[model samples]
Target chain A: MAGGGNLVVTVSPHIKSPETTGSIMRLVLLGLLPATLWACVLFGISGIAVIAISVITALFCEVTWHNLRDGKGTGRTWFALVSSLVVPIGVSAAGLGRAAPAAAIALMSAFILSEAGISRQGERRHSFDGSAAVTGLLLALVLPPLVPWWIPFVGAFIAIWLGKEIFGGLGYNVFNPALVARAILVLSWPAHLTAGWFRSLGIDATSKATPLMLAKTGAAADLTAYYAPLLLNNPGGCIGEVSAFLLLVGGAMLLWKRVITWEIPVTYLGAMAVASVLMGVDPVFHLLAGGAVLGAVFMATDYVTSPVSSRGKIVFGIMCGAITMLLRVYSKAPEGVTSAILFMNMVTPLIDRSTMPRPFGVVRAGRGVRK
Target chain B: MRVRLIDLTRGLVQENPLLRLMIGLCSALAVSVKVENTIFMGLAVIFVLTLSNIVISAIRPVTPDNIRIPIFLVVVSSFVTIVDLVLKAYFPEVYARLGVWIPLIVVNCIILGRAEAFAYRNGILASTLDGLGMGAGYTLVLIVMGIVRELLGTGSITMMGVTLISLGTGFQAPTFMITFPGAFLTFGLIMGALNKAQSALAERAARRATGSAGRPTPVGGV
Candidate 1:
């Protein structure tokens, strides 16, 4: 009777039981399902195989490393493994069948090793967090399917180790781990990673060039051709990256679940659209091409690495979109989303610091510096 | 003899240029991609370090303190030029591979660091021993890093155009290892491990000296 009369209240900096890491990771996985299913429908068994191999390898590496280092059996390892493995497979499967096996194996191995190695040395192995796997998957998806497998591995390693762990794991990292992996991979293996594109579900996939690639190389192919396949299931790039429609569906689910906010995706897409129009390029082609939609929706809006405040998120999104277009149009590389995300990741700290919410009835300390 | 021995031993651990002082990292990271390059770099460093130390020590008293840096550079450059010529003439392939890095030996902080810190203050013989010891330590680290990077990146160990060992066809070289970022990653991890090892060794030594049970000591501390 006395317990029934008791009242409990929670305030700001409140420990409201929101979504757990596992739950958020699960949602991200769920969000990816549409794109993954689409990839399967297009690419066939080989897509499934690459995804399976990447996921199994990532899970095995994480669990084994955890068990060996921690000296105790934690059942939570399975959850982490599942989350990490699924993301990469979904992403990679989006543009599978074009990449070489050796390259894939090497890249994935490097990625897993880097994540595991770095986590082992630090406080509490966050390798089981599913973040690294998501990073690897997203990176693999954006890369041209014909790339050496080793490129993803290297990218994964850089993303997890340098991008995440170096700044202190998971929540501490300022940049999106997936973008970090993709950026490093693109920089290191530019030739293989950006060589060609593949068609989703096509029987005889060949060296197909993405619209962005054609634009960069001055190919006179009509822009409509690129836009048409992108709207459907064109496999000229990473697995989850090919179909703009699938990406939008998955992204919409994430937005609806509040897994990610609309600020980043909206501003990023908006900026890119404006930039594309200004550049005299078709805005729709830019939006549907490369890793723009995947990056803006999934990679750029990562909860841990992105800004907290609504305003900060907007700034982050604008910068990501602007830098992406700049890199795509001006830079030598065909895809700019990875670099854009990484570059914005580097600036996220400053964005957060400047954009912190003001106190009640109090003037903000450096109003001039406020964006 | 004891003083010279002490000087020699100092570079091995107490002030190991690579591990403790953290000097001469450019060549260490850059040329340590291959075992052969590592060996060549190590020998070149030893030659440059030893000769510069001896020459600098001999002229220390006559040299002005203000112009010491420039004078040190000149001496280091002269020795590096000689090494560069020798490598180019005899080990043409190594020279070709090492490229600008061989000339860059003059700028290697290890040689100049020893010249300014130890050689400029010590006797010729003592400086010579110190240089050799420091050179050996630097060489050891370079070789270890080289072996690690080469073995992982390429999955094989080759020396002077000879494949000494192969890890079979499955061993595919991570091409990243041949790039700049790979060098940084290898150097960083190796440095971290070396830092851990040095702290562990110091703790053991401190316990032995004090006749007490050794506890783990923090790195970069005595």
Candidate 2:
């Protein structure tokens, strides 16, 4: 069972299995579920709302851009996209109920056009194909739980459009779309993105900095007591930063399923740990604070953006961790997981090119395998 | 004096210096954060460009080909200095905001490019019009970018020390739009939208052409 993609042809030594992009993406969603569920449980209704808006917007953007780019008879669909985008920019906290109808109509029409088979001759239906879903969910996971409704909507648009589609969609995207969106959001509306951190089970929200931020204050002797709460419960950061334990569990599941390799996660965390010691910060605190675990496990190991060869993956991870530590120690920004991962994403191509393994039976430059 | 309309109109859209020709972008991007800065910058560029074009065209007959680039620089820089002095004297606020970009206009590709490409071969009248048109095109794009960036970046458009448009007190403008990367994003999106529109127009024209030819098209059978 080589999955549903039976007709795919490769260069040579085609190893076929029951794995498609959909299946891998499915595995990724499962991997992320633990942290996401924990985040939702911690943040409550606001967290669920943020996730819903982001995922729906992500789907809307994916479907809208896909149909506009590839679908036939797309005049009406084009109108739908413009109206949906224009209408939502006005969606404030007091006006969510008003924007709901417009969003619903636009989404429903797009869903019908894509799924209900208004197929025009040779035009094939575009699948939702969990890739966009993963990006949306990952974007939600990285967002602060107490964000305004429009923040996730805008983030998802940026993720799908500027981050992914503009780079020629999916595997062709150079950076992880979720991280790209998060970085831009952090830059665009720093006040909105940085503030509004919620606590678990409806405790005090807003103005509470993440553990990474607190570490910047240098409570050198008082840090150890916070590790237990930071590990299992939420302190104050992005939604997914709630439980390092659950995120690690999900990461381990992915590792066991071979969805993600050990090189990136292991090297990324290890490098951060070692570098933290070098920088005179507590290594365990560095490892556990902010998005280090989530970023190392999920963001850095993105298949499209990460390097291919084993050596390249190691280089990528080590550099990511090093950059994260450097930014955390010296930079004005509290955490640097997003920036570090994006920086490594930009460097991934160079790493892949440098570390590409030679063909079988080929010794050095002078020796020939065929001869 | 041969005055061709194409010489004046072409730069407006068909060959916008910033968007289509992709020249004079350094100053364009750098000074495009606010609407007022763009207006003054556009004026400075237009004044220098027109005068430089006229001078370069007038000197073309006597100016030797080998030394013409140096000659162009001299003429362009002379005009740029005039603009710099005038802005410094009259519009100190805009000048202070524009800062180094005003002086940097001496090396602006639009002015030098018009001198070398159009004015050197054309008459003064044509060169003058070309310069104005190109400058207008540059101004148009700069203003559009300025308005977009300023409106989104600051949540309002303030011109001439007066508030023109405000998004309201609740609006938290994205500070990113005023940053360096935002200029690039605005430029790219504008260009992309223009490209998409042009492609759509071309496609429709092709479809119309086929339909008018009365051939039994593929769609006709379907």
Candidate 3:
């Protein structure tokens, strides 16, 4: 056998980094494990069931989509499966409701079928990468537990087809697919999607109004009761939302592994903190009670959606935080993170274009146009 | 007389106000949500476009070139007022559904655009044909968009309270298809498809013209 026939091809920017796409994805999966495990401990068998169903459905969808689109099946199906499972499982573990499992399955199936159906009869089959599953999972995590299952399916379809495929697929998308799905779902079903709040384990679980909701309706509730539990990781919310501590830990791990940068999450959370302080609201409560931490760190800071440069990421984060706070306090809805992220996603191209790093030893010209 | 027919037919494809010129998009996007609203708006536009064009063309010779813009506005506004009043008095239901958009037609760029571009230069007969063609084109686009949006948004198509098509039991509208963003996406997609079709047709025509000349081929002389 000729050695040249079996030779592997590689390209530069050949300066090697330790990370591979699979490694980065695996790190993200690892970062999510703590919150997922915590959710399981709190929510019990329903949580486990949802995770199983979501993962299975996501994998099935990915395989089916790949087979239909590419006319041949390949590897990476398992990764897609796991990524999809994470969202519904995360939501269910946070106590979305009994419908979580069924909804996840339906959405996964529909997303796969629709994507497959839309492709031409004899195009090269698209890869069954883990991206769609990851998007579905992230969207599930941000959504309220009480959302009708069909909503996620629509979100997944929009996120995958419109947000991702319309711009070409996966890495080409300017925004996070998960955040896109979550935004559409929230906007479409504000009443059902934003209402429910399930408490954490060993906490006095009650159907009390969320702090953001209370702020919106001008109906004040006892602040200490809500604030303390949330700070200590005991507040009621979506699966990953209950534990600010765990999310931070995961975020830190992501930063340490160089899986994500410090600019977006740091600026976003800092802005939220500053804004909360300036508004004279409990800063701790604002950070802990809603999807702010999870969104800022995990969803908004998605590599595809967030800004490319360090400074751009910082500006993007601050904008997201400020908008999230404003919407939470002044708008009709309880959560604003998803919308803020999606809105920021739309402007990412502009941000990247304006803030591209200057070439080495080059003199800059006059001020550029503003978006 | 022959030139007038070309001017009239141009609006059907070459100068389609909605797809080609991208004029009057606000009402086009908003009212295209329902087949009924689209039809109503389309007919209203036709009436307004024709009347405004004829009136503008009749007064074109006397109207000063410097003040033509304002004079065109006045003509368009008067026609819009007439439409608004008539609709309010007779078709109260459509009047209510159309709401402020009917009055907004006075300022619609399509009306003003035609008044300045075509009606001001052409004779009354030519202007009338141009107006009719443009109105017909606008109506066709609106109806197509309305059918698409209504069918997708509600999972059914209804015209004047009669259901033309339904997706059957357990089928519900996406709801977003009727909202603002949906309107943008739908308009964008339709515009894109229109552009694609137009280009493809042009390419085919160019290819046939080029192929015949370059090859020195005789048709039916094989």
What is the Å distance of residue B107 in model 1 from its true position? 2.0
lDDT of each prediction vs. the true structure?
A: 0.74, 0.85, 0.74
Candidate 3, residues A16-37, lDDT tens digits: the string is: 8876666777778678778767
Q: What is the TM-score of chain A alone in each candidate?
A: 0.75, 0.88, 0.77
The sequence of per-residue lDDT tens digits that candidate 1 reaches over residues A1-371 is 44675675546876567777877877887777787777766665545544544453444454444453465444544444455545545455676534444334544455545445645446544346665456556655665554544455445556556666655466888777666656556555566666645665552223576667776787835776666677777646677776788888888998898899899999999999999888887788889987888888888888877888999999999988888888888887777887788788788889999999987878655764566
Candidate 2 Cα deviation (angstroms), residue A84: 4.8
lDDT string for model 2 (A1-371, tens) is: 36667676668767669888889899989998988887777788888888877887888788878877887448866776766766555453346755653464456456645653646676556676788889989899899988877789889899999999987899899999999899888889998898888756543232377767777876334777668767888678888888899999999999999999999999999999999999998898888878999899989999999999999999999999999999999999889899999999998889998999989866876655774
2 or 3, which is superior by TM-score? 2
| Stronger candidate by lDDT (2 vs 3) | 2
**DockQ score of each predicted structure, in the order shown:** 0.29, 0.67, 0.32
Residue A1, candidate 3: C-alpha displacement in angstroms? 13
lDDT of 2: 0.85
Docking class of 2: medium
Chain A of model 1 scored by TM-score: 0.75
How would you encode candidate 2's per-residue C-alpha lDDT over B73-156 as one tens digit per residue?
999999888888988999888889999999999999999898889999999999999999999999999999999999999999
Q: Interface Cα RMSD for all candidates?
A: 2.7, 0.7, 2.0
Give the best candidate by TM-score: 2
Best by lDDT: 2
Candidates by DockQ, descending order: 2, 3, 1
